[model samples]
Target: MDLREESLYLAPLYSRFPLTIVRGEGVYVFDERGNRYLDFASGIAVNSLGYAHPKIVDAVTSQVKKLTHISNLYYTEPQIELAKRLVRLSGLDKVFFCNSGTEAVEAGLKFSRRWGKERGKYRFISTVNSFHGRTMGSLSVTGQRKYQEPFEPLVDGVTFIEFNDGAALEEELKKGDYCAVILEPIQGEGGINPARREFIETARYLCDKYDALLLFDEVQAGIGRTGTMFAFQHFGVKPDMVALAKGLGGGLPIGATIINNRVAETLHYGDHASTFGGNPLVTAVANVVLEEVESLLPHIRKVGDFLGNLLRERIAPLDDVLEIRGIGLMYGIDVKSNARNICERCIKEGLLVITCGKNTVRIVPPLIIGEQEIKEGVYILEKVLKEGSG
Candidate 1:
């Protein structure tokens, strides 16, 4: 099939792969020609349970028959239950749901602004090389010039600090002009960089001292992706707010901004709302997804260690491989050559991976992936790297 002809009517936004996926099962996706490929990308970290998961299918199918959506003015059982579960797990007071990760970031930004408005604080401190979202507010704090340059005059007063620079964060917070310090515990789009423990601790301390909110963007690294419920758990420091999405609904679209009581109390009724936020369909699936993730936390930790060791022993020795960085199931293999070319070659060899940053190949397989599957995927990666180098 000619992609140009097939995509003539669609928006030219994505540089798509050549193959058209028709179905997926377990950790593999089948293209239109019925060729199966190990899907390590997992829809860019959204398919936590892989495709055609029985529980997710049951929840989605059952909910569609019962109730798919209802107004926020009315309460739905699934939405309420999921909110309670997230609140309990997050140790946060309330959750504001939206359709995607960017919306979650937008809500987090608004909540911090409103909470700090009366206190004469409005600026936001984000890190350099971080990615929040594409919308105006989230884009302003994204810290990537490539994503923000086209959309100038964004929500002002967001300052970009170096990631993991504790002194810079403290120096800025000392000014007492910022409302929030937004960070991604593991920088996903910025090359799978994990935050140093001391950096997060400093952020927590300074936020409390300056009365600023510490917002964590866990969209890419949350939901058992990092072997923990949330990436910040590894450091033993909690944030004032957390933005979650990507894997929350197992495949369905959902985003949530979990806030503490202090921020929740500052906002009154009608201050913010979403038309289809936390609708019955997505929330019901999210309930199952959360439960399944909690159960697999132990497995994730075990396999995450296995994967790390396997990569270091196998792929790390390749001539083109430069560096390996990641924690849990998420990893980035920086290569001496173009990462995009490597990803394309992997796709051709019946393995699916994606590129992050400039020369890094990112691997974020399903949380349920087993040792055998991991070996299969890594074998293909090794073959691709050797062939490319040769």
Candidate 2:
């Protein structure tokens, strides 16, 4: 099949760009025409270590030589190791592995429901403009009305409150009947907005007051993307559970939901399961990815801070730049004009970028991206913005 023709067979779920990327390495991707472009989006925050990292490649190769997969019916060493690493890194007590961010979210939702059932409450509270995933359970908790409107008659009892509004969050929690309150510490798809310290602290206290589980959806902001392993650490507030994915496997698909011991006990045998979840191949890759991330976290943070500051200093003063909001490497620039035009211009300038909600440009390069790449990418971005305005 002509690869470009494959688009016709696929569902119209994504609004794809014109270029077709065939391969990637480090912070760069090459299209079918062999044009190189600096990858600033990092596959929407999934390629944590960037493309074709040696460690990730070796880990997957070695695991394939040993055992590619065995269903969750049996024990797997890689899965156990990965789970342990995630639990230790996240400060959570246990983990449930899955194949994607949405699956991890689904697992988290089920765990939250179970926690509430044991305590006799079933309501889940989430924030406005928050995104969980497209799956039914996750979709139900997501706050955006647009995503939920087409798939109405969704799972009920989910209350949507305004984010960064401490009083509103507390008032909703005061109802005292919620099973859990799920939120994205940094809303990724909702325009890359970070949570306020007061809001996070209030949510923690309210969950404790009413015995509700605090779930942080760090799928896009976790695994070194935000200069911290998880966004919750930045707030200094510990959540009971965290839904993670995107960067966990360094490129290979993987996701996980980490839960504390008290809340984890709610999930028992036969309560939930995924056939490909915790397979040896994916877990082995994840183990290496986690190790690499832990070892290089210092560099990631340093580079992220440098780039974030540079972007702020350079773009904040621009006439067309509305605002730049983010922490570390995850940033969103709200432009005065349409983001699509700016993104297209950047592509023409040999840079890969993605647009987020409204007029925002999402800048989420791989954690392993270096300073020079950041400088060059920003230079291209500056040129695009300047020329696009002209």
Candidate 3:
């Protein structure tokens, strides 16, 4: 269907860009008019492998032909293997698979509540300006009131605290009513804010002291997007559970909540289930994504540094540039002006980008992205800012 026709039929939930992508390959996407643009956003960090890698294509196609899906009552090799790999990589004991990051967050919330049921502790603590998920349960814990106000009478019993405020966190956790403390290691939608080392350590310690679960929502920052395999690896602090999705299945719909033995043992049979949760097709693709990330992670670290350094060289001099903050491939340029304006201009200049936080343009390209693509993308961004600055 044509771009205009598709817009008419589809819901208006998204304020889509003027450009309409028809196909994607490598670090570039082609619009219906055959215009190619460097895709730095990577479908908002979903296509970490870039586009159509033969290995992923082959694995998914083969699995679809063999057995696309079977009920959870039966076993699938891909599902089991993928689960084992994630559990091993995460250092967690068990996993619950779902269809998206929001589902994963919901599952974690439920598990934490069940684990704390005996004490009647159902309160959750999340950081201010954090974006967990749009689902009812996940949204309740999300700190940003703008998204929650409209969806009010939410899950309830959620309290918001300042991000990186160790004192505030400790004060609340000490109250002894919190079942879990959830936060993103690197806040995605709240602007690329990374957690402080002290704050992370404090959360782990306090959770242990108060008998609360520390949950990391790695949906946007996991799967080797950070220099490490997971963002938490950088802090040397492990969480009781982690919510993962976006890059987990490499463009497929898959999410998982990896929990420790304590929480794992608490979750009995029938506590949670999903029809397409661990289906063969998606899990098979996730296995490939996991394998691809193993080799690509080092590349992401090197190239991510290259991208950040180049941005510092180019945009840091701009009058409107506020600051550049992030690590690995996840970076954001805090701007004095509107971030959407810069993103719109970048798209017209043959580059695609997105905005996060109040006024920052987010850059989370495919992990497979190389230095050349990053340079070209940044060059266009520089040109856009330079031209508009005067």
Candidate scoring better on TM-score of 1 and 3: 1
Which parts of model 2 have CA positions greater than 4 angstroms off?
1-4
**Considering only N, C-alpha and C atoms within 3 Å, which residue pairs clash in candidate 3?**
none
For model 2, where is the 10-residue window of minimal lDDT? 1-10
What is the Cα-based TM-score of model 1? Answer: 0.99
Sorted on lDDT, best first, the list reads 1, 3, 2
lDDT per residue as tens, model 2, 289-322: 8888888888988998899888987777788898
Q: Residues 276-336, candidate 1: write the lDDT tens digits.
A: 9999999999999999999999999999999999999999999999999999899999999
> How well does candidate 2 score on lDDT at residue 93?
95
lDDT of 3 by residue, 1-390 (tens): 456876678887788777768898888899888999998898988998989888889998899889988889998899899989988998988889999999999999999999999887999999999999999999998888889999889987888899999889889988999999998999999999999999999999989998899999999999999978789999999999999999998899999999999998888889889998989999999999999898788798899889989999998999889999999999999988778999999989999999999889999998999898899999999899887777
TM-score of each model, paired residue for residue = 0.99, 0.97, 0.98
Model 2: clashing residue pairs?
A: none
Model 1, runs deviating above 4 Å? none
